[model samples]
Target: MSPLRPEELQALLHAAVDDLRPAPDGYERIRAGIDRRRRWRVPAYAAGGAVLAALAALAFFAISPRSHTEVVEPASPVTGQLGSGALAPTASRTASPPVIGPALSPSLSSKGGPTGATATGSATPSTPAPAGSPTVTPTRRAENSSPATVAKDGDIDGDGVVDPDISYNGTALVVTLSHNHQTRAVTLAGVVTPLHYTVTDLDDDGRGEILVEVSGAGGVTTYDVVRLQPDGSLRALSKGPLPLVVGASSSSGAGFSCSGGLVQVRSGTSDDGTTYQVTTTSWRLSGVTFAPVGKATTTSYDTTSSAADPFTARCGTL
Candidate 1:
């Protein structure tokens, strides 16, 4: 081996020294990278803290109870219709209209028997009805010595002839007796008028009785029985503006007739070419009162054709 020159030896020494120098500042680069990551972590940590605070605030309000306050409003008025075809305005409950009908009297009785119209010039004689026709039997009442006794063939004054005169005084009916020349006035209450009269032998005693029919409100008719006294006086046998039939409360007109010791009441009602009804009530005299014995009713309707629809019902002895 030859001895190395100084320059070559120095060059080899410099190369070895260059190779031995520390790797280019690796710890400084790692420290710079760590500093950059710390900067980004600060912002992320701040955003995460803000989001947690917002979530806590939302949870706190969601569980709170709400207020319960009532809001009341006033009721308004309303127009309502009643059962009787009337309209009423009210603030609360609607009112019901009054019922339109005749009041039944306690003194009168309803019974059944054969029916016949009173003898009238316009009335046609009908065949004797079968048993159980609309008729009422009278109840016996105690007899009294009244001037006008309710019996057939009664001449209270012992007069053989039965004569009585009737006249109207606007508000009442004036009855004049022939035997004693006595006069009696009968007045009606509330829109009632004396219509006409009929005579019949009610008790079959050969004496004549008078039946007076009067018109009243709502097209209702009333009947009154009067006996002719021998002393020229009149006695009322029954108290009645009685209804015509069992089911009829009102009527446009009424007719009465006495035959075979029975009195019959007939009433008829008609609508405007649409419907019609007819009813008959039979009554018998007992003492001073006439009792209903039988009743019959018939109803008819008009269809689109010429034929009429009819319905009929009978009750009591009829």
Candidate 2:
């Protein structure tokens, strides 16, 4: 083989290139034809899709379960009437009446029957008394009915003695006796002013003494226990001053009285305070002096202060 020259090889390549044809724009042309076909069928494809969706919805509705709905109507006025097509309403029940009998007259009941009156006239009505008629009689109380005398002592003067002064109607009555040495009589009258006195056997000598409360001016009051001497004279066994003082204008004084050998003296104050109260229980025996054994003093004071009013000084036997 001989080595070919450069000119001969170049001529052979040019003749091969000239014999080959161009691709004739085949890929672009095929793409354009495909687009035109799709454009023509787009409406028909859309219509087919809509028909399929409609068929599926119809099938689902035909097979699905359904709920029942009831219709209610308004009640008619003739609902409870017989033969009505609607349901008959219940009827309201009523109660029966109570049994009774004929009333029996009073005159008819007098005859012999169960409702008749008894032979004792039980059915007869009672007659009432007339108005202003007296139903009860006025009782008569006894007059001049004197109180029974318990004990009595005589006092010649208006003193607080059972002998001379008598207590009647809460007042002491003084009795006076006049004698002609043969016959004696007495006159009694309420004492103008009653003075209280106490009698007691203070000395224990079997003889009782009288104690009287006396008040003077300037807050001075005295309790005098006087014993009746055998010589017809009165002697003071004990004398003491009062612990209370009353105003000069006030009608205040001490009162003494004795009963069963016990002596009590009461004193009043001028103002509204505790009235003087003195109680003597026991006494001492001396030749002439009679003293209180036990004495208690109680006083009432004014509302302003605790100061007690002047009262009788309480002292025992010396």
Among the numbered candidates, top lDDT falls to: 1
Tens digit of lDDT per residue, candidate 1, span 1-318? 989999999999998787676768889989999999999999999999999999998887676533222221222222222123221122111111001111110110111100111111111112333333322111121122232222222122212222223455676566543334456665632212323444445654434565555444553445456664434345666443242222223223345555667766655676554344546667776555677776565544343447522221111111
Give the TM-score (vs. native) of candidate 2. 0.24
lDDT value for model 2:
0.32
Question: Model 2 over residues 1-318: C-alpha lDDT tens digits?
Answer: 999999999998898798888688888889999998899788778989899989999998776543222221221122111111211111100000000111110110111211221211011112332343222211111122211111112111111111211122323222121110111122222211234333334433333343343344465544444444434334444333222222322445444333333344445544544333333233344546434646655444333455533334322110
Candidate 1 ranges beyond 4 A from true positions: 1-164, 169-172, 180-195, 229-233, 237-254, 267-277, 294-318
TM-score of each: 0.35, 0.24
Measure candidate 2: CA RMSD.
46.9
Going through the candidates in the order shown, the clash numbers are 25, 21
Full-model lDDT for every candidate = 0.40, 0.32
Model 2 residue 255 CA deviation in Å: 6.3
C-alpha lDDT (0 to 100) for residue 311 of candidate 1: 23
